[model samples]
Target: MIDFWLAAGLLLLVALSFLLIPVLRGRRAQLEEDRTALNVALYQERVAELQTQQQEGVLDAVQMDAGRAEAARELLADTEGVAAPRVSRLGKPLPLLAAILVPVLGLGLYLHFGASDKVELTREFAQAPQSMEEMTRRLERAVAAQPDSAEGLYFLGRTYMAQDRPADAAKIFERTVNLAGRQPELLGQWAQAQYFADGKKWSDKIQSLTDEALKADPKEVTSLGLLGIAAFEAERYQDAIDYWNRLLVQLPPDDNSRSALQGGITRATEKLQASGGKVAQAPAAKVAALLKVHVDLAAELKDKVKPGDSVFIFARATSGPPAPLAAKRLTVADLPVTVELGDADAMMPQLKLSNFPEVQLVARISRAGQPTAGEWVGRSQPLASSTTVPQRLIIDSPDK
Candidate 1:
C-alpha cells in the first residue's frame, strides 16, 4: 500500500508539473520584459543628456551626433535577443490559481470517484492475515468495497459462521442469495445460518429453503449436512441417520470428512435404538439397480481405431434428460471388458439409475476423448433399469 501510494504521488507530481511549468515560464518572460524596459529608459536618459550638452556648446554637432549614435548602439546591445513582451488576457493570478487548483481538484475528484478502497483491500488480502479477526476485517472491507460481489459475501458469511456470529452470517448469506440467485449451495448456506440465528429453532422459512435446495440437487452437500444436523437436534435420530447416510455416499472414498460423517451416522443409530426405534436403512441400498455390459469393437472397424483411443459407456433415460444417468470411461485397449453401471455409478445424485424406469445403453469410441461426441457409436434398445441381464454393445457405426 505504501508503494502504491508512493507511485500515485509520483504520478500526481508529474501531472502538476504540466500545469506549473507554464506559469513558471511566464514569470521568467515577465522578468525579461522588465529588464528590457529598464534598458530602454536608460537609453532615453543618455540621449537627453547628449542633446543638453550640445545645446550648452560643450560639444560640436559631430561629437553630439557620435555620442547619440553610441548610446543607440549600447541600447540595441542591451535589448538584443530579448523577445517582445506578450500580452496575456489571463494574467499572473489566474495561472497561479489554476496551478494550485489543478492538483487540489484532481485529488478531490479522485477521492470521490476512484477505487482507492478496493486497491487497499486488494493489498491487505495479498498478505497472510495474522488472525481470524484480521481476516474478517479484510473480508468486511472487501464486501463494503463491492457490495454486489456475491462470491465475497459468501465467504464472509462462512467466516462469520466460523466466528459463531450466526445472525451476521445469516444476513450476509441472504444478501448473497439475492445477488447470485438462489443457487442450491447458497440456499443451503442461508438456511443453515438462518436456522442457527433463530436460536436453533425450526421455522417454515428455513424448511422451505432446505427443501428447495435439495429438490434442485439431492447431492447438495451443505443442505444434506444441515438437514441431518437439524433432525439430530430435534431428536429425530432415524431421520438424521437417513440424511447422513445419503450424504456419506456422495463423499469420495478417501475424503477426510468420511470418518466424521460415519461417526455421526453411528451416533444417530445408537440414539434411535436406545429410544426403542429401529434405524431405517436408505432405500437405494436395499435394491440398487445394476446393469452389466460387455463392450467390444467390431472386427471391421478395429483396424481403423488406435489402441489408445478412449471408450465411454453410459446409460441415459430414454424419455428424460439427455445427461447420462450412469457412465464409465475406458480405453479401446480394454475392449471386450465387462463393466457394471448402477445407482452407485450415478453421474448426479438426482439422476440415478433407480430414479428412471427405463434407459438406453450406449458405447462410444472417441479418439478425441470426448464422451458425448465420438468417432464410432453403438446403442441398445430401451430396457428396464432393474434388468439383471447382461447386454452386449459393439462399436461398429460412425457417429452422426
Candidate 2:
C-alpha cells in the first residue's frame, strides 16, 4: 500500500508539473511578444519625429537621416539581446519540495495506518464478510437506498436463493422483473424459483411463464429443457418429445443434454413402437443407429490372474436397477478373450452408444481378480462410445 500510494503521488506530481509547463510557456511567449511590440513602437515614434524635423527645415537632411539611422541602430541593439522572457522554469523549488515531501509523507502515513497486506483486501471489502441473513439485511438496505438498481435487486434475489428462502427469492425476482422489464433468462430463473417456492405441482401459470420466456427467446435452452422435463413428468410424452426434439436441434452435438434427449426419445419411441404407431421405414442403409461400449482393463490386472483367481466380467446397465441389465458373467479362463455384443443379443444388444444413449452394460472385474468380489473393481462411469445406435440401461447407484 505504501509503495502504491508513493507511485501514485509521484505520477500525480509529474502530471501537475507537465500541465504547469504549458501555462508557463504561454506566459513567457506573451511577455516576449509584448516587449518586442514596445521596442518596435518606440523606434517608429523616434523615426517619425526625426522625419518631421527634417521636413520642417529645423535640421539638415543629413542630420535628420543620421538621427534616424542612430535611432534605428539603438532600437536594433536594444531588441537584439532582449532575453526571451524567462519565467524561471524552476518555480521556486516549492512544488518540487512538495512533490517529494507529499509522497514520503503519504508513504509514511500508509505504512503506519492504512496499509493492508492481503491482495484480496479490495474484493473482501466489496463483498463484506457476513452471514446470509446479514447480507440479506444489507441487500435490503441497499435496495431501499436505490430502489431501481437492477444490480441490487439481482444480488438480493440471489442471496435469498442462497439462503434457501425461495419465497423471498421469488418475490425479489418478481419485483426485479417488474422494474427491469422482461428478460428471458431472468424470467426463466425467476419462474424456477417461483415453481419451487409454490411446490412442484404443475400449474398453467408456470407453463405460461415458461412459454412466455420461450416466445421471447425460442432457443432459451434452460427453459426449453425444463419445459421438456415438466412435460415428461406430466405424462405428456409427445409434448416432451416435441420440446426435446426442438431443443436437441439447438444444442451442440456433444452436449450433455443429448443423453437426456436420447433417453426421452427412446421412451417415447418405445411406446410408439409397441403401440404399432407407423414409423416410416427408411432405406435399410439409411436407417441406422449405433451404440457401443468398449472396455480396456487396467494394465496391472491384465494376464496376471490364475484360473483359481476370482474374476468377474459382466455388463451392467446404466439406467435403473431391477431391470436384468447386467450381462452373464465370464471368467478369465473363458473361451473368448474379448466378448462383443450386438443387436442380435436379446438382453443387452451391441448398439452404438451415440444417439446420446445410456450405457447398456457394465463389465465388472473384482479386486481379487475373481467373480465373487473381493472388492468390486471396474470403471464405474458409463463409458461414452458412440451415439449412432441408441440403447437403454437400468442402472442404480453404485451402493446397490
Candidate 3:
C-alpha cells in the first residue's frame, strides 16, 4: 500500500508539472505567431502595391524596382529568414524542474514544521480583542519587543485613552512626544490627556496646549473650540469672540455645531456685559486717593538722575480689555495691579491706573542703576514687601 501511494503521488506531481510548464510556453508561442502573421500581411500589401504601380505605369520602372527591393529587405528583416521565433525546448527544463521541486520542498518543510503543530487561530485571535485593556497589554508587549516604534507608542496612548485612564494616557502621550517631537496628533492627544488630568480645568494649561495645536494645524477645530472655552473661563470675552469667529468661518453655515458655538458666544457676551460694560469713561488723571504704576512710563525712567522722576499709584477695577473698549483688539493683559489705593499717582492723567480696593503702597530708589520702568519695578500691596500676594478677584462681580 505504501509503494502504491508513493507511485500515485509521483504521477500527480508529474501531471501538475506538465500542465503548468505547457501553459507558459503556449502563451509565448501564440504571441510570436501573431507577430509573424502581422508582419507577413504588411509586407505582402507593400509588395502588391509596388507590382500594381509597375503594371499600371503609375510609377516608372526604376521606382517600381526600388520599391520591390525595399519591400524585400523589410519583409526578410521582420520575418527574420523563415519560421518565427519559437519556444526553445531548452527553456522547458528550468520551469519543469522548478514546478516539480518548489512544491515538493515547500510541502516537505511545511509538513516538518507547520502541519505537525496545530495552529489555534481562534485562540490567538481571541487573545487580542479590540478591548482597550487587552489592546493595551498587546501594545506593551509590542513596544517591549520594538522600543523605537513611533506607531506603537501613538496607538498605545490612544488605547489608554480608550480605557478611560487619562493618567496612564498622559504618560504614554509623554513618551510619544519624546520619541516624535511635537507631532500634531501627539500634541493634541497630550493636550487632551493633560486637560483631563488637570481636574478638567479648561482655564490656563488647556489654552496653552490648544494654542500649540492650532499653531501646528490652523484648521484644527477641536483646538479652536477648546481655545474658545479657555477664553470664556479666563474672562477674555473678546478673545472668546475672535476664537469662535475663526471657527465659524471654517464650519459650514448650516451646521448645528454653529448653534452650539453661538450658545457659547452668547454666554460669554452676557458675562462681559454683566462684569462691567465697556469702561465707559477714562478715570480722572489726578484722582486724589489712588496710586498706580505706569508700566510704559516706568520703563522710561531709565538711568535715573533724580529722585522725583517716577511715581507710585494704585488702580481699582483694572482688570478688563486694554485699549478702547470699542476697538477690535479688545484683548487684556494681566491687570488689577495692586499698588497703594490712595497715592500721589492718582494725579497724572497719563498714569491713570485704578479700579481695585485696599491696595497699600511703598516706594524704592531703584538706586542709581538704570531706573527700571515703573511697570517692570514690580508693584506690591501696602505693608507687603513682595508682589506674590494672590488676589482672589471676584471675576463674577467686577465692580466689587
Candidate 4:
C-alpha cells in the first residue's frame, strides 16, 4: 500500500507540473513585459526633457533630434532580446486553482472507482493470513470485487460455516449454486447451511436441496451427514443410524470424522434399544466409484531418474477440462505403490471421481514437482470410474 501511494504521488506531481510550469513561465513573461514598459517610459521622459530644452533655446532642433535619436537607441538597447508581451485571457489564479483541484479530484475519483481494495487484497493474499477472521475478511473483499466469481463465493460460504455464521453461509451458498449450476456438493452445502440457519428447523427448501443433491449423487457426503443430523434431531433413531451408516461407506479410511460418525451411530443404536426397538441389520455397503491403480517406472528409465524426483498420479475426466479430479503425489522412489482415487482424493469439492463416468489415469515423473509437465508419462485409456480391479500404469515413454 505504501508503494502504491508513492507511485500515485509521483504521478500527481507530474500532473501538477503541467499546471504550475506554465504559470511560472507566464510570471516570467509578465516580468519581461514590465521591464520593457519601464524602458519606454524612461525614453519618453528623456525626449520630453530635450524638447523642453529646445523650446528654451538651450538646445537647437538638430541637437534635440540627435538627443531623441540617442534616447531611442538607448531604449532599444535596454529592451533588446525581450519577448513580445502576450495577453493571457486566463488569470494566474485559474491555473493555481486547477493545480490545487486536479490532484484532489483525481484522488477522490480514484477512491470512488479505483481498485485499491483489490490491490490490498492481492498484497495480503501474497502472504499467509494470520487468522481465520483475517482470511475471511480478505475473502469477503474478494467476493465484493468479483461478484460473479462462483469460486470466491463458494470459499466465502465455507468460511462462514467455519465461523458459525450459518445465515451468511446460506446466502453465499445459494448464490454459488445459482452461478455454478447447482453441483451436488454446492447443493449439499446450501442445504446444510440453510438447515442450521433455520435454527435446526427443517424446511421444505432444505429438503428440496438435499433431495436434489442425493438424486444426482447418492454418496454426496455433506448432504448425507446433514440428513443424519436432521433425522437424529427428529428422534428417528433408526433413520439416523441408517443415514450415517451409508455416509460411513463414502468416507476414506483416514477421515478424522469417521470416529465422530461412529460415536453418533453408537448413540443412535443405544437410544433405539432403550425404546425396545429391534435394531435392523445394517445394509450392505455400496460399491463406491473408487479406482485403485498400481504405478511403476520402466526398468530402462530407472538408471536415468533421480530417487527424489516427484511422481504425480491423478485421474481426470477424459472429456472435460484437463484438471485432475483426484490426485496423489509421491516420489520416484515410491514407485510400484498401489493407491486409491476416490471422492476423498478430490482436488476440489466439485471435481470428484464419482462425478465423471469416464476418466483416465495418468502418471508422470516431474523433477520440478509440476503435475502437467514432466520428463516421463503414462496414461490409461478412458475407463469407468467404478472399475474395481486394480489397474497398472508404467511411465515407459517421454512426456511429449
Cα RMSD for candidates in order:
6.6, 19.8, 23.3, 6.9
Lowest lDDT block of 10, candidate 3: 323-332
lDDT of 1: 0.90
Deviation (Å) of 248 in candidate 3: 3.7
Which residue pairs come into collision in candidate 4?
Answer: none
The worst-scoring run of ten residues by lDDT in candidate 1 lies at: 279-288
Query: What does candidate 4's lDDT look like per residue over 1-400, in tens digits?
Result: 9999999999999989999999999989989999999999999999999999999999998998899999999999999999888788988899999999999899999999999988988898999999999999899999999999999999999999999999999999999988988788999999999999999999999999999987667668899999999999999999999999988877788999999999999999999999999789986644558999999999999999999999999999876556798999999989889999998998976567776778999999999999889999999999998889899999999998
lDDT values, one for every candidate:
0.90, 0.62, 0.57, 0.91
> For model 4, what is the error of residue 111's alpha carbon versus the real structure, in angstroms, after optimal superposition?
3.7
All candidates in order of TM-score, best leading: 1, 4, 2, 3
Best by lDDT: 4
lDDT of 3 at 326: 10
lDDT of 2 by residue, 181-236 (tens): 77776687687778778776767777788888766555566577777777767766
> How well does candidate 1 score on lDDT at residue 273?
90
Cα RMSD for predicted model 4 = 6.9
Which runs of model 1 end up more than 4 angstroms from their true locations? 56-74, 254-256, 284-400
Q: Write the per-residue lDDT of candidate 1 for residues 98-123, one digit (tens) a residue.
A: 77897789889989998989988887
How do all the candidates rank in terms of lDDT, highest first? 4, 1, 2, 3
* Clash count, one per candidate: 0, 27, 20, 0
